[model samples]
Target chain A: MAILNIEPNIAQPDDFYEALIDMHRDLDAEQSRMANAHLILLLANHVGDEAVLREAMQRARALVPTSSDVSTRPA
Target chain B: MANVDREYQGLAFDYVRSPDQDARVAVRHPVVVVGAGPVGLTAAIDLARRGVPVVVLDDDHKLSVGSRAICFAKRTLEIWDRLDCGDQMVEKGVSWNVGRVFFQDERVYSFDLLPDSGHRRPAFINLQQYYCEGYLHERTAVLPAVDLRWRNRVTGVTPDAEGVTLAIDTPDGPYALRADHVIACDGSRSAVRSLMGLESKGRVFRDRFLIADVRMKADFPAERWFWFDPPFHPNQSVLLHRQPDNVWRIDFQLGWDADPDLERQPERVRPRIRALLGEDAEFEFEWISVYTFACLRMERFRHGRVIFAGDSAHGVSPFGARGANSGVQDADNLAWKLALVLAGKAPDRLLDTYGTEREYAADENILNSTRATDFITPKSDESRVFRDAVLRLAKDHPFARRLVNSGRLSTPATLHGSALNTPDAEAFGGAMVPGSPMTDAPGTMRGHPAWLLSCTGDVFTAILFAGDRGFDEATIAAIRALGTDGIPVKVLIVTAAGATVPSVDGIDYFADDDGAVAARLDARPGTCYLLRPDQHVCARWRTFDADRVRAAVARATCND
Candidate 1:
C-alpha cells in the first residue's frame, strides 16, 4: 500500500471543501453533476482505497432515487 | 396607385413559372453552431477570431428578455476581454467588491474581493444576461467569417461519420443544412441533447426559490447584502444584490411548504420586502419567477458528431454565479480544441479530452454548490446548529475569518486528467507541480493555465529535487534532445542529505533543506509535480519518472 499525505498549508481541507462547494453552486446542472463525480473521484484518489471508493459510490448511488421511466436524453 | 406600384416593384419577389425541386443551395462552412445564446455566440466568435468560418443559427426573432445571470466573476470578465467585449461589459455592469454574510440575525462575516496578488481580474460584475447575449450577437454579426441567422430554428439534427446534417425551419421555409460539426448551446432543455438520448444525473433539491428583479428606492449600501434570518421570517432568508440598472435582484429560498402561486402576488411579496427594508419603498417588478432546479450533469458531452456546451451539458444552483461563467468556460474550452482539429493541427483524440477536463471542472462546481446549498439550508438539525456555530466563530477567529474571506463558497477549476497533465516522476511522490499563468510570459503554455513546465533555455523543464538518487547523463541528453529548436532547456537537480534518489534529469535539479524544498514545491520527497500554466499543479506522482507525466504534457501541448 502506498500512502500519500497532503499537509495543511494555504490550501486546507476547509478551504478546499468550501471552494468546491462554491464552484459547484455557481455551475449549471450539467456541469455540477460532472463536477460532483469528479470531486468524488479526486477525493477518493486522495484517500486511495478501492473498497472505500466502492462503498462511497454505492452510498451515493443509493442517495439518488432510481427513476426507471425517466428519459435519458442529452438535455 | 401607380406611384405605390413602382415602389412595391423594387421590394417584391419575382415569381418564376416553374422551378425544379432538385436545386441545391451550396454553402460549405467549417463549423455551424446552433443557438446564439452566450455559449453558442461565444463559440462562434472564438472560432471566427481564430479565422475559422462559422455560421450561427437562432430561432429568436429578437433579443432575449429579462436578465438571467446578473453576477459575473472576475475570470468571466477576463474571458470577455479576450473576445474584445470586456470594456463594454464592465462599463454597463455593476461592480461588487465587498460582501457580507449573515447568520440568524447577526452579521457573521464580511470580506473584500481584493486578494494579495496573482489575480488579474476584478472581484465580480453584475450584468444582465441579455446584455451579454446582445453584445456577443452584435459582435458576431459584423464578422465576415461568421454568418448569423436569426429567426431560424434547428428542427432536426442528424449526425453521421462524415458530418452533421441539420433540418432548419427558417422564416422562408424548411431548409437542409450540413456541417462538419454541430455545437448545441440551447440551454438546459437542449433539443439536440434530447435527440441523442443522453441522461443528466444529479439531485434536485426539494426547496423552491423565487428570484425577483425589482427597481426599488432604498438607502441600503451598495454591497451584496444577505440575510440569514429575517426578523419576520425565521428560516433561511433573502439575498439582495444591486444590479447595473438600479434594479435589485433578490433571491428567496421558499421551502417546499410555501405556495409558489401565492408567493408571486405583489401584495404578498411587497410587504415581506418592506419588512426587510424597514420602510415603505416604492418599487416596480421587472421579472419574477418561482423555479425549482436540480444540480444535474449529462452523462457525456459528446456523442459522435454532436457536442453539448453550456447548460446543455450541466446545470447547478446559482449560489456562487458559477452557472453562466462555467458555461462560458465550456465554450472557451471547446472553441480552441475544435479550431485546432478543424485546422488539422491536432488529432481527434484531443476532442475526447473535452469530456475529461470539463467534466472535472463541472464536478468541482457541483460539490461547491451542494455544500453552499447545505450551508445555506442545512438538511439536518444538527448540521444547522453546527453551521451557525461556525458562522459565529468566524466573527472572532482569524482562521474562521480566512475561511470566510476565501469565498470557499466557490471552488476553483482544477485540471487533473486532461490534455494538459504530464506524467509524474517517482521523486515527485504523486503530487502536482506549479504551472505558469496564461499571460504573455516567456514560458507560458498555450491552452490552459494548469501544467508544471516553465521555459528555461530551449525546452520546458519540470523543477525537481532529489529525495532518491540524482539524475544521470543519458536522461539529461534525452531532456536536451526533447528540447527542440526555439525551445529552451535547463535541468537543476537539488539533493538533500536524507533525500532519496531521483531517477530522471528531465527535471531541473536543486539542493536545499528538505523543509525548504517542500515549502517551495508544496510536496514531499519522491514526488513528481505537474504544474499548469497558471502556476497551479494539475497532477503529481510519488515515485520518480511516473509513466503518466509525459503523456499528460504531450496531450496538453498537442505533442501527442
Candidate 2:
C-alpha cells in the first residue's frame, strides 16, 4: 500500500488556505518564513509517519529548482 | 556603581601581615590553596575538617563584587552543609522550584523541579554570589587549621620532586612558601593556571548577554520565568529570576554584534526595562553587566604536585548556572581525596581519580551548557527555525515540550564507571548506583527530627536497611569491627517504618518514618550502601559481609 496519499486530502481546501494565510497576516517577510517553518513542523508531527513525510518532501523538492551543491544553497 | 543598591551589607577582610613574610627561609606547609573565592574557601574548610592545615591566599580582602552566580543547586547546598554553612545559605537565599516557559506572548508550560518533596533542601536557591562567598569565608574562621591570608597573592609557582613552592606578594613585601600540594581555586582568569603555562581549550560562543539586577516592590512569585521571542524582546530570549531582598535578575540575549559597553549603560538599559515592566514601574538598578561565555576546560586538572579545581579547571556558560555549581562540586570531590593523601592513608594515584571523574563531569556540564546556549541563541537560520518550531508546538503537544531546552538546570553528574567504584555483584534498581550521590530523605533520629544526609558525616558511611527484623548478631559484630578497623567506617542503621531497632553505642540508627529513604535506595532487609567521605556511593550489597565491605573501602580509597 502507498504510505502517503497524493490525492486531494483536505475536505475544505479553501478554508485551510484561508486559515494558513490568516496565520501570517501581521508578520514580516522574515517572520512569515518562520511561521511557515513552524507550520511544517507542526503538521509533520501531526502526520506522525516518517515515510509519508519523506515522500512528501521528495515530491515537493522535485517541483523546485534545487541547487546540485548542498553547500551553495542558502541556509 | 555595582552593588550600590544592594540590601545585604558586604564584608571586607582586613589585610593582616603574615608572619611567613618575615621568615628567613620558606616555611613548609601541608597544603596551600590559592584564591579565597567560594571554591577556595570550601576547599580550605574541607581540608581543615579533615585535619589538614591549608593556607588560603587571595589578592583581594573582600567577597565577590556583584551577584554573579545566583542559582545554587541542591548538590551544592549539600556540599555546603558538609562544610557547616548550608543552613545559612538556604536561610538567606530565596528558595524556588517552579519554572515557567513562554513563547511569544503566551506561557507554554510550567514545570515543578521538586515534584515529590522529602528533601531537606529545595531544588535550587537563588542567593547573591557575594553572600555565598561571605558565608563560606565566615565558616573558615572557626577552622583553626585554615590559614586564610587576605591580600596575599601567589606571584610565582615552582614545582619539583617533593612539593611546590609559591612566591607570594603582599603589601609589606614578597616572600616564598612551600607546600606539599597546591590547589588552584583562582577563577577563570586564573593566575596560578597562567603561571604554570597551562591553557584551557574549547569552543567559544560568539553571543553576548546583558544581565541587569533591578530592585523593585513588584509581587512576582519566586519562580524562574523564561520567554522566547516575546513581544517585550522580539526574536531574542529573556530570562527572569527572583533573588533575595526583592531584587530581580533579568538576562537579555544580545546577539554577537551588540556592543557590550553601550548595552550596560543605564541610558541604554532603561528603555529595555521599561518595555518589560510598564513605563511607570518603579525600580532601581543594582548591578549591570554584559558578558560573553565559553565552554572550556583544562587538559588535565592535576599536574605533578599542583591541582586545579573550580573555574580554574573548567568553565561553562551561565545559561544552566553550571559554572559556579560545578566548580563547587569539583572542590567537594577533590578535598576528601587530597586529605587522605596528606594523611598517608590513600595512595598518590587516588588523586588521579579526582582529575578523571571531575573532568568527566566538566565535559558533561560543557556539553549541556553548549546545547542550551545554541538553543537560546541559534547560530544559523535553520537551527533558529527548528528552535522556534519547538517553542510554538510545545504549547499544545507534550512531545514537543520535551524538545524545549531553556536550560537543563544544574544536577550532579554521577561518576559512572569510575575506577574507585566496586562493580555491583547483585541486581539492584534505583538512581543511587555505585558512583551516584546519596539521596536525602527526612526521618527521625533518637525521637528528634533529622535528615538522612545529616547522618552521613565526613567519613566512610554504610547505611544498612533493617526491614521487619533488626540486623543479626554477626552483621552487628561485623559493623562494629569495621568501625574499629584501620579505616573506620560509620554505620547508620535505617529501620523500616515502625520497625523496632535496638540502640547501639557505636552505630547510629534512623527511623525511616515515611519509607522515602528505603524507596529511594531500593533497599531490602539486609541491603547496604557504602558511601565515600564526599557522600558518593562507592559500593552496595544485598547482604552485609565483613570481607566485602573491607575490600570495597580499600578500593574506594585506592588501596586495592
TM, every model: 0.67, 0.91
**Each model's lDDT:** 0.64, 0.90
Best by TM-score: 2
Candidate 2 has a TM-score of 0.91
Task: For residues B360-386, write the lDDT of model 1, one tens digit per residue.
Answer: 888888877777777777787656555
Question: DockQ, per-model, please?
Answer: 0.03, 0.45
Best model per lDDT: 2
Fraction of native contacts, model 1:
0.00
- The total number of steric clashes, by the backbone 3 Å criterion, in model 2 comes to 0
Worst 10 residues of 1 chain B by lDDT: B436-445
Q: Compose the digit string of candidate 2's lDDT tens values, residues B22-52.
A: 8899999999999998899988999899899
